[model samples]
Target: MAKVQVLGTGCAKCGYLLKNAQVAANERQAGDVVEKLDDMLQVHEFNPSALPALAIDGKVVTVGTLPSPSEIRQLIEQSQEVEE
Candidate 1:
C-alpha cells in the first residue's frame, strides 16, 4: 500500500486535496493511506511555509498547489513502480 500524506493545517484547500487523494487512490486500487497531516513538524520537511503539499511515502511531490487528478494518479503509479 502507498502512504499518501497531504500536509496542511485545517484549510479548505487542504480538505479538498485530502478528499481527492483518497478518491484517486481508490480508483487506482492502490490501497493507499490518504491522510491529512496537520503537524507542522512533518509539514516543514517539505516546505516550512507551504500550506498544502502532497507526499508519496515519505517524499514530498508537490507544494502550495493542488494537483490534477491525473497528476495524482501518475504520482501513485511512479511510487508503486519504484516499490516494485
Candidate 2:
C-alpha cells in the first residue's frame, strides 16, 4: 500500500492537500493510507523546504503546491511501481 503523508501545520492549504490526498486514495481504491503530520516536530523531521509537502511511501513527491486528485493518484501508482 502507498503511504501518503501530508506535512503541514494544519492550515487551509494543508487541510486542502490532506483532503485531496484522501480523495485521491479513495478514487484509486488501492488501499493507500493517507496521513497528516501537523506537529511541528514531526513535520520538521520530514525536513520539507516548504509547507504542505507531499510524500509517498516516505519519498517526497511535491512541495508548496496542491496537485489534483488525478495527479495524486498517479503519484501513488508510481510509488507502488517502485515498491514492486
Question: Evaluated with TM-score, which candidate comes out highest?
Answer: 2
TM-score of each: 0.86, 0.95
After TM-score superposition, the amount by which residue 17's alpha carbon in candidate 1 deviates from its true location, in angstroms, is 0.7
Identify the runs in model 2 with alpha carbons over 4 angstroms from their true place.
none
Mind giving the per-residue lDDT tens digits that candidate 2 earns over 1-84?
789999998899999999999999999887889999998998887788998999998888999999989999998998888888
TM-score of 1: 0.86
Instruction: Identify the runs in model 1 with alpha carbons over 4 angstroms from their true place.
Output: 47-49
Question: How well is each residue in 1-84 modelled by candidate 1, as lDDT tens digits?
Answer: 889999998799999888889888888885778888998876877773567889998888888888877788899889889889
Cα displacement (angstroms), candidate 2, residue 3, comes to 1.0
